[model samples]
Target: MDRARLAGFLRARREALQPEDVGLPRGPRRRTGGLRREEVAALSGMSADYYSRIEQQRGPHPSEQMLAALARGLRLSLAERDHLFQLGGFPVPRHAVRADHVNPGMMRILDRLQDTPAQVVNHLGETLAQTAPAVALLGDETRHSGLARSAHYRWFTDPQARTPVPAEDHATRSRLMAAHLHAAYTRDGRGSRAAVIVDALLATSAEFAELWREHPVQSAYCPPKRLRHPEVGALELHCQVLVDPDQSQTLMVFTAAPGTESDEKLRLLAVIGAQRV
Candidate 1:
């Protein structure tokens, strides 16, 4: 690894960011330029000492996962993220098929909605980024990877994933997910990420494979989703999706019907979620 170059790049990105850029406050006593190294470490999900070591060019080589976290924490663009990987002596991720990078437009929207439950998820059902409320509301969707990264895969392969959705909607959601995967698999063809997921689901999940055989092709995300939170109970929130065509990323914003019990619950959720975060 080009430790010196990597450290310099990380430092540059860190200094270039303001506290407000990453949903942090600039306190009255603060005198450091941009975000503190500790703040960056917190955002990157690493210890302050470890991150400081890397910045000081005295740490061990950073793994690809750590670099990925840093990229997200730094809010780097796709090109910049690739550059970070290259600088760390890691190959840039191939971008022809799968895309996890949240486009700038979506990031802007997410940045503005600190209280709302919003997330940028790719076509393959992998959540790329989520707001604090989203983490609280949906139990941190960004915590998984591999086949588990796709909620559809998790739905069939693991029973625990159905906690959010009611039992009644499971069949419909499964069909929708299966249809979505089929469409993506067909569009991308062989050896595609979607195809890999499809193959895995077909082999492991009989229900998913059954749903796939039915050839359901609904691509549009349904509105007014019924999601249950262990803390908030059942919530009837509308799911508004904004799609970025170039990146195949969908930004979903969740809001409840105003003046209703659900609205009151969502308001409570903001307070409850903040504490959880």
Candidate 2:
């Protein structure tokens, strides 16, 4: 760990905030500006002595979990949190690295492609936003919360999520999900959001456990996707993925070639969805 830089960053973040900002009372007798070291320790759920040692640059390497707590306590933005993790000599968790904000370029493209089935998803497979046609195709996957918010997490936990995934394709999807999550876990290591999902699955899913042992470790998998929509029946569409490196968000647009039955069904679904909206 870069103790000096980490300590400096921590101290700076603590000093930049007011007691009121973190929902604490500022007593009249308080002489120092910003929050005290003790307050930071309390907010971070660590002992004052341990926290002080870190600020003093004398402590052992802080784990990723400790850094995450510090990030939360300091109310660090996604970029700031990433800086903290870097200073701590740990890669920021991929899920933690995901920013919910869609960039203007992406937004503009989404606006122009209103009739297309498109959605933006973060690195963790959480849908940040979706076009109406995308919602109609995927059933508004952005509606989930907590661990279930991740499409990867829900594939094993929610049966409804697997409904669109054909029985023949279940193994492939499961392998893909496991492989992608494995890549995430490898990147972030322990105390990561991906680890949390893996832990939960290890405890609950026998299938996940088996696949985790023997799965393709590919991080990027893009194949022509098949969707079994109840209203539109079956659709074989090309799944195009656009990545924003700064935000780690993916724009997945579904398209079918012209003069195809899938193309007609896609447009019809868009019209139907727009009418419902």
Local distance difference test, each candidate: 0.84, 0.81
Q: What is the lDDT of candidate 2?
A: 0.81
Off by over 4 Å in 1: 96-98, 274-277
C-alpha lDDT (0 to 100) for residue 195 of candidate 1: 84
What tens-digit string does per-residue lDDT give for candidate 1 at 42-140?
887899999999999997899988898888778888888999999899998887533866675677678778889899998888898888888878878
Candidate 2 lDDT, tens digit per residue, 1-277?
8999989999999999887766577899889898899998986779999999999999778998788778756767767878898999988667554455455456545655667889888767888667779988888786688889888889988898899877888988898888878876887789988798889988888999999888558656598878798887898999899988776677899999898999999988988893443
Q: State TM-scores per candidate.
A: 0.91, 0.63
- The regions of model 2 sitting more than 4 angstroms off are 1-98, 219-221, 274-277
Q: Which whole-number lDDT from 0 to 100 does residue 166 have in model 2?
A: 78
Q: After superposition, how far is residue 161 of candidate 1 from its true place, in Å?
A: 1.8
After superposition on all CA atoms, how large is the RMSD of candidate 2? 12.4
For candidate 1, give the lDDT of residue 131.
85
Query: Cα deviation in Å at residue 231, candidate 1?
Result: 2.2
